[model samples]
Target: MNDADPLPDLDPLVPSTARVYDALLGGRDHFKPDREAADVFLSMVPHAREAALVNRDAFLRGVQYMVREAGIDQILDIGCGLLTKQRTHEVAQEIDPEVRVVYVDKDPMALTHGRALIDTGQTTTVVTGDLRDPSGILAHPQVRAGLDFERPIGLIVWMLMQVAEAEDPDGIVATLMAPLASGSHLFIVTWPDTGDPAQRALSQACLETLGNGWARPVDRVLKHFQGMPMVEPGLEFVPRWYPGDPGREVPSAEDLKPFERTQIAGIAVKP
Candidate 1:
């Protein structure tokens, strides 16, 4: 991995979703705008930080299951945010050094940082693409070259909530998965709308500050899988999935905070 190149000129006043997420994760790469947005979000939803941590932890667990248990050697992580430690490639490659991973994100800064932090050798690469345009991402030269469609791929869609309802999130997922060979798997983490006023306020705050994203109802979010067979413990709260994974200490459902219950995750496989 090489040092990141000098970033392009960008407005510090503008809040970037990736940077805001970094702020939520307690990372140091965010700017004033990002921190301000995060503060505003936290003011309304005090558990936002804990929720972010839970989401990340669950995502990493999903990656471990996909690579170490499911025996998937290739991963396509769509809407991957800023590069962070214990990310997809790190977790996957740790299990098998030859694992191939392609990180996809529309944020220029995220792409740049990912490119810098990752090995960028034959085993890992970062591509610039939007999740809404699944076809564009699938057809990207780097994506096609970095992964083989004939092989089972572990597709991670951790930020599906970023796509608005008008954008046909379900269709986007179907298009992305259609070309992959059977036995491929999908890992998803998203906020599920429970009609709570606080949740609605949080969704509105995200849309206003980040320029896009809203929480979908749990049933609607589940439809994104398009009837694919789910892995064990289907569509549970993020912290509840695979709690038995080594070193993970999951709280009981009754003990979980409200925000923890708001986010749901699951892994499904194409038969």
Candidate 2:
């Protein structure tokens, strides 16, 4: 990967959601502003770091299931943050080297870092796009050329919480999924509001720091699936999804700490 300075026009003073997420994940691609934002978030939610780790682990598991069991050979990871250790392409390609992946993100830093790190060849590539513009992303030339729309595609919407309600998050999901062939899977990971006062406060803290962190209720989040059939163990806390998988051992949702229940995830298939 390129160890050079960030892009010339990129402002280091502004804390990007992607960078703050990277900082929360204990990654090295964040700036001082991002680290400060992450510190503020952690102060509000003491288990923020642990929640981030759980979210990443759940995402990796979802990717593995999509490739190994669901027979999905191509992926479109929307709002993909900075390049992490076990990224979508890495996990999917490990199972099958021919798997194709297209990473999309609005953060300039993420795009720059991804371009420098991941191979932009036939099997993998990164594109600059915003989640708010689903049509634009779907029409991206690289995205169009990288994968076949005629077959099943795995759509990973891991940063939906970063999109506020005013931005039409549900419509965004619908638009992104409408064109895909049947049998395509939709994997989502987002913070869920469980009506707890503490959770509301945490959501406020996130909004103040991230500018677009809107934690939706479980029902509203389920609407993003657009009536598709959810995979077994439907939308649940990150730690509880597919707990039977190797290396994933956790207590029941009722036994989980308040902070441990901050995030929720699930996979659904278009019928």
Candidate 3:
């Protein structure tokens, strides 16, 4: 293990953002506190589970696009929660066997669970790192060893930016992205606070209970990736991007309306 990667003490009574997410995704890697928090959120907003599933499905689409269309062979999945379903490495390496991936998260349980579930021999590694410290993540021994900083990479920040408000989300993104070479792509999924007042309240309650996340509007979130050129159907709902098939149907405004207030997703490239 790297010196920067320290094992954190697990608190079973407190609901971690990652564990709450795991419970939402129908995974059993959480404690009682996590389940209680998830249940409370669900009670407030019953559609949350469906929304999470949709976001996850859309995430896979983005990853597949990066590997098959964008020709990206390396990926850095930051804030990667517990390895529940189709993971970054599984999707990327399936397309290209030589693909290398690094999963970074601050949660020790997530790191430990990921190690147990994922095959490390395929140049895939799970390391403890905070997204707020972009410099440390970019320079971590695991990241430096597994990924080529000089080459293009698919950077996935799914529902991760929600955790950092003090860091100035835009600056955090910019700091990490500045070093990657041109052609590098950024895939982001954010939970934008754009719903009805009641929905917003529910979202806030969920965050307060689970801990360490905030919901921001899509336009405000887009400002973070100022210089990067977005792909077609830019900065739309997660379900809106390449809706029916990878290169097929383009989702309509009506198609996006359902998920509009819940989540937003986008893919941009460094020019």
For model 1, state the Cα shift of residue 218 in Å: 1.3
Worst 10 residues of 3 by lDDT: 252-261
The top-ranked prediction according to TM-score is 2
lDDT, ranked from best to worst: 2, 1, 3
Query: Tens digits of per-residue lDDT for model 3 on 1-271?
Result: 5445776778888898789888988999999998998888777777777877888887888899889989999999999989877988888888998999999988878988887778473579998788888889988888888888899998987555465666677877888898898899998887666655533754675667965556677777788676688877777667667622446565665555443447777889998
How would you encode candidate 1's per-residue C-alpha lDDT over 23-94 as one tens digit per residue?
988999889999999998898788888888888888888999988889999999998889877788888888
Candidate 1 residue pairs in clash (backbone atoms < 3 Å): none
Native-to-model Cα distance after best TM-score fit, residue 1 in candidate 1, in Å: 12
Model 2 per-residue lDDT tens digits across residues 153-258: 9999867887777788889999999999999999998878887554665687778887767778999899989989998788988878982254456688789887
Provide the clashing-pair count of each candidate structure. 0, 0, 0
Q: List TM-scores for all candidates, in order.
A: 0.91, 0.93, 0.91
* Predicted model with the maximum lDDT: 2
Which candidate, 1 or 2, has the higher TM-score? Answer: 2
Clash number for candidate 3: 0
Looking at candidate 3, what is the lDDT of residue 6? 77
- C-alpha RMSD by candidate, in order: 3.2, 3.4, 2.4
Q: Which of the two, 1 or 2, has more lDDT? A: 2
**C-alpha lDDT score of every prediction, in listed order:** 0.83, 0.85, 0.78
Q: So what's the TM-score on candidate 1?
A: 0.91
